[model samples]
Structure formats: C-alpha cells, structure tokens
Target: MKKVFLIICCAAALFSCRKLDQPNTREFTEEAYWRDAQDALDALTSCYENMSSDFYYFGNEALSDNAYVAGTGFSSVSLVAGGSYDPSNARVTAEWSYRYGAIRKCNIVLENIDKVPSMDETLKRRIIAEARFIRAYSYFELTDWFGDVPFFTTQISVDESKTISRTAQNTVLDFVLQELSEIRGDLPTNVQYAEKDRGRITRGAAIALSAKVQLKRGVWEEVKNECELLINSTENGTYSLLGTYANLFKVANEFNSEVILDLQYGGGRTFSTQRSFLPQTVALLRSVLVPTQDLVDDYIMLNGKAIREAGSGYNENDPYTNRDPRFEATILHHGSTITDFEGQVQTILTQPGSVPATNSVDDQGASPTGYYFQKHYDPTAPNYNSGLNLPIIRYADVLLMYAEAMNELNNLDADIWNKTVRATRVRAKFTDAGATEFPTGASQPQLREIVRRERRAELAFEGVRAFDIRRWKIADVVLNKPVRGIKVSSGAFNKDPNGYIIVEARRFEDPKHYLWPVPTFERDQNQNLGQNPDWQ
Candidate 1:
C-alpha cells in the first residue's frame, strides 16, 4: 500500500532539484543586471525550491520506518544490520548527489549576491545569511551521514571535481560552525515578505539548525548555549512550544508558533502527499511503514512511568488507556477514532474481519501491522490531501537538545532536565505533583539513560532514532537484539492474525552497518577517495 502511495506521490509531487551542470544559466550583462530587488528574491527563492525534494522527507525512507528488513531484492535493507555500512551503495549516491545539487545552488547564490546592487544592504545580508545557512546545513547532513564527504565551496569544473578528496569530518564541521556563526548577526529573526517569502530562513531557523548540528557532534557547551539563546529570545516572535502535541503536526498548524523551520507545502504550486499514509488509507498502503512494537512500548504511562516499571502492573489489554496520550494520538491503533482537522471521524478498521465495510476494505487490503500514522494527515482534505508543512526543526527539538547537552556536560541540574520533559506533557495537563521526585541524586549513567529514553518517547517516528542510536554508542545493545513483534499466540504465522501478543528472540544486525561506504561511482571518479574502514 505504501508503494502505491509512493508511486502516486512521485508522479504528482516530485521534488525540484537544482541543476548543477552549468555554473551560470540565463545570465545578464553587467550594465543591465543587479539593479532590482525582485532579481535577488527570485534567485533566493530558486535556492529554496530544493526543499520540494522527496529526498529530504519521504525519499530518505530507509533512515526511518518506511521500509522493512527483508531479503536482498530491496534497497537499503542492510541499515537494519546496525554495524558497518559499505559506502559504495546507491543510498550513498543519493545523499552525495542531492547534497552536491544543493551546494551548487549555494555557489550560485553566493556568487550572484554581489551583483544585486539595488537591493537593501540589510536585506541582501539576510539573503546571503540564508544561503550560507542552507549550504552549511547540506554539508552538515553529508558529514554526519557519510563522514569525510567531499566538501566543495565554489563551483567546480568537470576536470577539477575528479581530484577532490573527502574532507575530514572535524574539518567540515569546523567550517560549518564557523559559517553559521559568522552569519548570525546579519540574518533577520524572521522574514515577513508576504506569502511567497514566508518559508525562507530566519534567524531562529539558523540558530536552531546550528544547535542541532552541535548536538549531533556532541558539542555540549555550544548546544546548550545556542538552545538557550533561541528559547529565551522573543525578538522576532519566531519560537514557542505549541499548546498540544497534536497541534504540532496538525494539517491546519502550518508555521504555527512552535515551528522553527519547516519544508512548507501549499495547495497547487509545491505540495506533498504525506496524508496518504493515514489509517483511513492504510488498507491500501498495507506495509509502507509500520511502527515497531518496541516503539509502541516505549511511551511512558500518564503517571510519568514506564508501564513495565515495578508496581505499574504492565497491563497489555486496554493498553491505549493509561499510557501517554501522545502514543495513541500519533499512532492510530485498534479502536482509535480519529477526527480529521475538519472534524470528521475516520474509518480506521482494525480487526481482520472488521474491514471491507467501507470503500476498499477487506482482509486483503488491511494494514499488515494493524496500525496507522494519524499525525499530519487530514482525511477530509481532498483525496487524502492535507496542506501540512513538514517540520524540519521545532521548539521541542531545541528543548531536548538543551537537556541532552546539559546532561552530557555533567553540569545538569535536575530542574533543567525535568523542565524540558514536563514541557512535552504540558498540553496533556500532566503535572509532576504526585510523581516520583526528580532523580537529583542519580549518577551520570542514570541521567544519560533518562535523557535517551526521553528522546525516544518524545521524538518517535520523527526519522531520528535509528541515527540517534548510532551516535549514542548503544546500538549494540538496542539494534542487535530482535524485538518482540505481534503474532498469533498459537504459533501460526498466518492463522488467527489478531490473536498474537508477542514473545521475544535474539535479532543480530552486523556491527559494520554503522557508517555507509562512499559510493562506487564516487570512488571510481575520484582516485583519491577510500572506502570506510571495513567496507573496502
């Protein structure tokens, strides 16, 4: 079913990538060009156009739950191995190509900015800052995923490209941090240039992204300080935590108060078909992406404790109740009656025989996992369409970053970590009134575990966990172990589908699955390149 949706989305809403073959296209003479504000805006908007790529969102499916680990016929199935990654894979190609495509746009923007003579100096600086932020962002993604990726600044000629060696991760990170820091003062907090200009980079977005980069590299002081600046500042009305967890992903909540940066979509021009994954249509998308039972069990109960914790009783039946409300709201489970943004209850049938009551319902068409994603989907919004903007960074992310940074720095006060976690439950009316006292006496290991668990529970299915596990040095314990998935209690794989609760077994992914190998084409093209340690 998910494959169908991918086909439909790819056909109708394909991403627009920047062309890299030509250094300059449709150029103007020195005497006539650089004399107008619109030209600058047009060029800037052109750079922003890269966000439309499915590459940034759905296309990076292997990074998240979109695909499952099966036999060798599929791409990226080896990510489940959890160890070393061969950089020669096609996934590396996709990452490298798309990033270089973005870098090319940055080169164009940086070189052309000086020519926009008529634009306001401040406005031009902001535009330049925006371009720098994007360039830095692309490089950051590249380095984090494939460490020691080839870093290019100015446009490269065909002959010169072959000689470029991969930059060391530290060197690339230093450059990105430097670039982001230098542009901090020049950018505006938010750009208010009417409708078309709404989604462009603002100061808040830049700092938020910089904070994220810092967090990934384990830069404790910088991460904490940057997050502090953003959370405390109200200069541009650019940051705030939304009242409800649901509101953060609602189709109606585009560019809401909590959003720092989002890949904005609209009615006709640039749009995404992500809404097609809702439980209402999960029957058709039988197995696109299913949440793991591990994730389902991770959400803490309303009492701010894990269900399996001592004294919690860990009731399997009626599990939806008493658990964190965000779990049910985010993942459409059995008996969940989700009303679309327009106030219409969706038909998300869960039982084997319960489906086929509506338009394409039947055992043959039901979700293979009997679950659906309810967030950011609008059933009433035409053909499973919702003008939902996909968030790239949000206030909650910054809060979590701060918590993790402080915890890692070993100077964390209990108040700081607890405040961040409580903020997530604020909309649910959760209070610490009767809960266990904050773990002020806990050791560093204990506190780190708490932060890690908090991130898993809060940011589940946000496409960050698999990579997060890699960075935290716990993938050996977490990923190598096979998790219990729902199955028939009678030991039949195909019979009585709903009778399954679960039992566990050992699941081992290779240790070499951590770093992806540099692509074969890239290595072939540049003799100076070498594959990651174990891959060659």
Candidate 2:
C-alpha cells in the first residue's frame, strides 16, 4: 500500500484563501469532512503528502556546493549561487507558498480533529500529534530558509494574516522545540508501527528532529542531550545503524533499521533521484545534478589520511584509486561499472577518446565535474520511475550529530569515538582499523574539523550540506570562491595547469545572504513582512 493517501483533500477545502482561518468551502468542507473518523484520517494524510514534496528532498542541494545547475536560467540554484536572487525568484516564491500550503493543511486537521465523533481517543491523539509534527516541520523549514517569517499556530483570518509581522527566528525555534517535545510521548516508537505504517512519525523521529532543530541553532549541549535520548533508548528499538552504508539507500531496504524519517515513495508514487543523478550512459534521461571536484576531494584516503596528506598513497595521475570506500559507493567516476536498463553491466567512460564511447567530461547536460552521483540509484526501477524513498533523517546522521556535539560540549574521548564516529566508519566498511579508529591525543579543534569533514563525506548530495554550512557559519568563507570541476581535454586525462577548471563562481554576502529575503510578493501583500537586513 502507498504510505501517502492517494486522495488528497482539495486545496480549496484546506487553503482556499492565503489565510488559514477561513472555513474550507470546497467539496469537503470542515463540517462535512470532520463528521466521521475516516474523514479526519484522510485530512491528516493529506497534510503528510503536502509536507514531503520533492523540492525539499532533492532540489535544495543545488543551493550548496554539492552540485551545480546546468544552465544560467533563473533557477533557484543558479540565482542563489550567484547571489543574484531576490524575493521574486520563481523557486523562492514556490518554496514559500508550498511550505505555507502544507502548514494550512496541518492547521485544518488540528482545528477539526476534535469534532470527529466516535473516534477512538488514542487514535485522535496520534492524529493530533502527527499534525503538530508536520506543522513544526513546516515552520522549521520556513525559518531556516527565510529567517524570520509570519508565525501563526492557530488559523488566522485573511485580514489578520496580511497584517501579521515576521516573528523572530529564535521565537519560532522555541515553539518548534516545545511542539516536538510535547508530542514525543503521544507518538509511537519505531518498533510499535505496523508494517503498513512504516513511514509515520515516531517518538524517535520527534527526538531526532528536535536534535536537528537545536543543531541548526548551534546549541551544542541541547543537541547532545536530544541525541542521547534516542541513542540511549536502544532497548526500545528506537534506532540503529543499518549493517552497511550502501544498503541504507537501496529501494528494497527503505524504512530499514537506520531510517528515522523518510518521505514514502513506492507502489505508484515515486521520485526521480536516479534520473537526476545517473549518467546518460545508463539512464534514459540525461543527468543534470553533477558532483563537484571539491566534494570529491573531501573523501579521505583508505589509509586514514586525506589524499593530499603525505604518505597517503594517492596517485595524482590516477586519482580515483586508493580513495575512501564511500567515494565508489557515492560517486560514479570514470571507469565505474553500472547495470544498464537491459540488465547488462556497462563501464562509464568519462575520458575523451575512450572505447565503448560514453559521455565525455563537460558534455552538455552531462556531469560537468566528471562525476555522477550513485548514492540513490536504483537499478531495478523502470526507466526514471524510481521508488527509492528519500531519507529525511537516518541513524548515521544522529551518530554524526552526537559526535560533533559531544566534541563541542566536551573534548573528544575514546568512548564517545567508539560509540559514534568509529561506529559510523565501521558501517562504511573501512577495513583498516587505523582509518576507522580515532586518533589518540587529538585536540578539540582538530577533532572538530575531522567531524565536519566526516559529515560532508558521509552525507553529500542528501540536501544536508547546505544547512550544515549555514549552521556552521562557514558559507561566506567556503562559498565565495570559484567552484572547480575536473580537467577535460583530448588524449590522456591531464590536470589543468591551474589544477582544476572553474565551473561557477559563487558569492555569499554576509548578513543578508545568510538568510533569504522575504518574498517580494509576500511583502507586497503583507506590508508588515520586512525584508532581511541589507535586502530590499
């Protein structure tokens, strides 16, 4: 069965006006829809469907250094990278409206769930908890992207919504934390869900989300506390890392032990993660989102050192050899083998004048960086209709967050390393014990950098890098320089004289660019919604 409800409540019934206060007048009005238990369930399901759209799942990566957009069109990625977008960009406008639209659905459900007569009290509480979880999620996304935004928990009239001013980001975050905390006990644990309800929010998920909210705010102690709650609840089977790193992303292994929260896509509904990342050699559609050389270099060598470090066994002439195991699992470089649509294995040839001619580096719509993403590719999917669920939160992420927060709150210790960072590396299949073990006597500053690099390598292309950079306050430093791609020319693959070719120059103006400007249209509609500092 599809995890999401196929029949979504009509938008007119949930959000006819921009303001959520007005009663839904569409086919399923508040009175007509809330009359029965099934009606409440359907409305609740619609909120989930609206909250986990594809844009947030995949498109947000382009806002960071993980991937580059193909064209110079007015796309959100291009505009944001160039520091040229304003409130009116189509993608920005869509994101604002989409999040609010989902919030409206949640509000409708929360406002009317109590009216369903004969509904089991336990069932009603679960539905209310789920709605609040989604509402908190929507608000988190809104505040993270746009900074201060119009905040309203209860449905407000159109006039009131128009006149409402932006709430401070800290205030919104406080509400998000409180909401998640209150709903934790009301939701089921990961082990309590039936097979059919695998993707619903759970107690562990609420805790994980709370940790993430604190992580974004740089509250290291709070983040550590929240992560420990879930990590220490192992007896309840709340969460654990899957046996292998690669298996965590397979379509057949979705909702596995490691997945805390994921957007459900199967049965008939699906996503295009593979289509967007697979090379044209294997996929019917051309690849658009290509990885950059900067990300590729971040992966450490198998010998427990960075490729650039001395005695790391890194061959500059043959660069892909002796690299991190994750490099092969996450990236499709030259000479990587892929099973084609015909169930035949084909080697990808990214170099010029190679036999079995594959797409050359820098080919139009091909991988501009000579690297395609293999992380979420599902070979069994028919054409571009892949059923692989996008993981919103995973056990590995919790471990990483715990490791980072612990390092910040207290210096890195052997026990913490074994539980979090070392455990993550073991799951990644690192055979050399040195590569997976924590270095003794490592200073806090050195360990901090190590943890940050681990996060970039482990979670690349998962739409987390953007937030990671922003939360770390390093976007201005890392994003201002030019993004580089691999050297592409005739004959043997030779490095460019300057090392790497500049693909795109990115700019992140401090203060204003850290937060997106409030949509010009939204500001125009609501005069009280002021723009971010230095933006107008």
Highest lDDT, which number? 2
TM for every model, in the order presented, reads 0.83, 0.92
Candidate 1 lDDT tens digits, 420-505: 75676666456644232466587988777766777776666565675677677565566654433344233333433445533223
- What number of backbone clashes does candidate 2 have, counting pairs of residues 3 or more apart or in separate chains? 0
lDDT assessment of candidate 1: 0.61
RMSD vs true structure, all candidates: 6.3, 5.0
The parts of candidate 2 lying over 4 Å away from their true place are 1-27, 72-75, 235-237, 355-358, 489-496
C-alpha lDDT (0 to 100) for residue 236 of candidate 1: 43
Candidate 2 — what's its lDDT?
0.78
- Lowest lDDT block of 10, candidate 2: 1-10
Query: How accurate locally is residue 358 in candidate 2, as Cα lDDT from 0 to 100?
Result: 51
Model 1 spans > 4 angstroms off? 1-35, 51-55, 58-88, 191-196, 235-238, 267-276, 280-284, 339-344, 351-365, 432-437, 494-511
Q: 425, model 2: CA deviation in Å?
A: 0.6
